[model samples]
Target chain A: MAKKDDSPDGLKLDRRNFFKTTGLAGLAESIAAPAEAAAQSTPAAVGPGDVPVRLNVNGRQIDLMIEPRVTLLDALRTRANLTGNKKGCDRGACGACTMIVDGRPVYSCSTLAIEVQGKQIRNVDGLATGDRLHPVQQAFCEKDALMCGFCTPGFIMASVALLEKNPNATPEQIKKGLDGNICRCGTFSRIFEAVSSVKGGQRG
Target chain B: MKAFAYINPANEKEAVAALSPQVEQSMPLGGGQDLLARMKDYVTQPERLVNVKTALESTVTPVGGGLRIGAAMKMADVAEHPEILRMYPAISAAAIEVGTPQIRNQATVGGNLNQRPRCWYYRNEEFVCFKKGGDRCFSPQGENQFHAILGAGPSFIVHPSSLAVPMLAYGATFRLAGPKGERLVPAANYFTLPRQSLRMENVLAPDELLTHVILPAPGNVKSGHYEVRYKASHDWPIAFATVLIAMNGSVVKEAKVVMGAVAPVPWRSAEAEQALVGKSITEATAAAAAEAAMKNARPLSQNGYKVDVAKTAVKRAILRAAGIQTA
Candidate 1:
């Protein structure tokens, strides 16, 4: 409990008192008047310790106490009980952890949960409306676009985001759109067919 | 990733003020695609990370007959922007070729320019290479297949930036904001070689933020970007070239030839530019310029194949810039 290496409070407390005495803390409070000024507005830094994090995942609000080191994918899969997206490479290379944030597909494993607090997040869990599968999901099942089923959720999410944006995508564009996700079973040809065969457009 | 505090600053002034003097203690998070990956690998352990996405510039503006693009703008927007596609096609071409659709949507302009080398020795915790503050680099005697061919020394890791090639070819300048003030650094001097900077890749300090890239207007020049990759989809290039040639009718008046994924920095070849200065950009002239570009390339033991790949990229880049049919 006494060792400075044990807790971040050792350095945090010193920095807090130093800023308070110098009146620099007042300067930080006066100018930063934005909604994102939650942690910085207060004199104390948030954590290596647990702080409150409110996430909006798949149209449902889930609140939890998470450390800053927890990624968006980990927070969604572990605490929120939304485990549709798989973690393939954990790095940004593999797209198994892909999720749509504000109309763009992003690598959720590399993104911090705290940074995406105010953005609209949509994952594989939000896609299907009960028995009626999403167009991309229905296409995947019909065309057998998946073999292992591990990468299916991420692939479905990526395809949904792509087709919703460019519904009239050509074969080349479809190939480039879903290039992030890798089916180790090498079912790319069938995946391409599933994506391109969707008639009309996906607005969502 | 190590335990740290995260802060989303509302402005660049707040971002730099919150940074620690020690570079390793505090870092400015751009896209988090590069920094977070490094953090997860334990290659970088910062005590605090300041999110600069909303704080930095995020809009593109026309300035002094040139374009000033915000550093926080995503690569997806930059690749599809109509003005960028019309005015600077090479820049759009390079941006479009970056990772995947998902990566382009997430990666930022500043993040792409300031990314670290993709050397396996640097990423692995087992090998304490020069980039990790160790005494020696392990690439020279170790597995050297993807190592550098042109710039080889204490560290042989090629710079992992594709946008920097076209930025240097267009003679763009990066606006860097720091605690002191703001300063504009030329793209030619922005990236550093291993001997110049051992522990880091670029000249930016820990507290500084690259806000915008100001590109000068391309005056009657043809630009082309070409990259030779092992995979057609979502992979790092073996070698890439960006060639900008100012042509007077049919003869080349000026040329700027830069290559990426071949050295510790975005390598600009003066020999290739000199070879094409006074000649018409025909098939033979483009081949001669490409030959001159790879003349000084001394490959490592396992990377001799990269020399031919890089030479083909240079020749094809010249031919494409001249609007010639290149197969």
Candidate 2:
């Protein structure tokens, strides 16, 4: 981790000093501008510190005090104790951090928890009702769609959202809809079979 | 991500006011789709992140004959909007191909347009390349399979906006709002070249907020957008092309050909446009235009394959514009 300097702007404006530091001379004079807006710049800052945030997750409003930079995935996993969603490739490439927010799937790792307040956010933790697994989950279990099971929840959530939107999805739609999720277990053939055999899919 | 103060501004004016004059101080957040990722990677360390989702409008309103797409309008909505599909099919087509459905659902139109380059060297914090205030670009001497082949320079990073290619081909303008008020910049002029400024890709100043994308009326034009992605399961395209053909009954009255992921900007191929001006789009003509488009390509050591991929994209776009099947 970088030892971030306490400077508010993250850079020094002294032309000679910046030039000497970065060894960029000609661009220094043009780049260095005074912090003129710093005077009138007091907006309602939420946090470098933790602040109260309420999110409607799975059906209930879960509240927490998190830093402004805390991602939705981190907030849920670390605070709310919803660890069903995995954090594979937190950069939003892998679908392990996928979640459904307001009827559409999104990368939870890329979404800030504070920004998604009041949104109907659903994670894999809330999928089942008591002992009965969600149909997609049941299908995955029956079809043996997972090996390591690390990427299962994200795939299940993405599948649930996909099936909810298009219950009678065709094969092509199933392929396209579940494209965001990946199973490193190399159980894709079985995963596709599982999704395909779910019939009209499960309801929320 | 370095800890930062956050603000959810009430309106665009408030958001503009909240912006710091310096780029490093404050940043506008729409959906947190790109900004948060970069913050996590330590690529950009803004002192404050101003949530612009509520500040910027999300409506897609009819502007005379065309549409004015709000900066905060989600990509999922843009891809499915009836007006956009009917008038500017290329925009919708391009929008649908961005990342995956999840990313499209979360990422905004303006965010897509203003997103940073996906060059590996830029994304990896280990390498302090030119964009990171370092002296030289590492692409020329390093791994550059996905780097720019056309219009390369001190930095060989390709412009990563898929929408900008179709937007420029359709002749759109971006509305920028700032402390100094609002001004419109043409899509062609919105994206800056490597020579223009190595620090940033576009003309957007640190304080200005890209408010809306105003597209002029699309009248009697056939358009096609084709993208070649290495991973259909969600990855950036190898290269893509957008073609807008204004036909005079049978022959091409005018043509606008723009390609993405090929250069530092949504590169408009005047050579291809010139080739198609007075000719009907046929196997021969389209091939000729595609050939002309690649005539000046200066591919790097590893990205020579992209030139051929780009050629296929341009040719297929031409055929698709004419509503013909590609074999």
- Give the Cα error of residue B211 in candidate 2, in Å: 0.7
TM-score for candidate 2, please give it. 0.91
Retained true contacts (fraction), each candidate: 0.64, 0.70
CA lDDT, candidate 1, residue B283: 84
* Candidate 2 colliding pairs: none
- The true-versus-predicted C-alpha distance at residue B229 of model 1, in Å, is 0.1
For candidate 1, lDDT tens digit of each residue in A1-204? 112231334223233454456443343344432233354553235677655676778887666566777888877775555789988898877788999998888989988888888788999988889988988888888898888888888888888888888888888878888998888898888988888888555422
DockQ per candidate, 2 decimals? 0.34, 0.33
Candidate 2 CAPRI-style tier: acceptable
Model 2: residues >4 Å from true position, as ranges?
Answer: A4-43, A202-204
Summarize candidate 1's per-residue lDDT along B99-139 as a digit string, tens digits: 88888998899999998889999888778888888899998
TM-score of each model, paired residue for residue: 0.92, 0.91
lDDT of each: 0.84, 0.86
User: What is candidate 2's CA lDDT for residue B52?
Assistant: 91
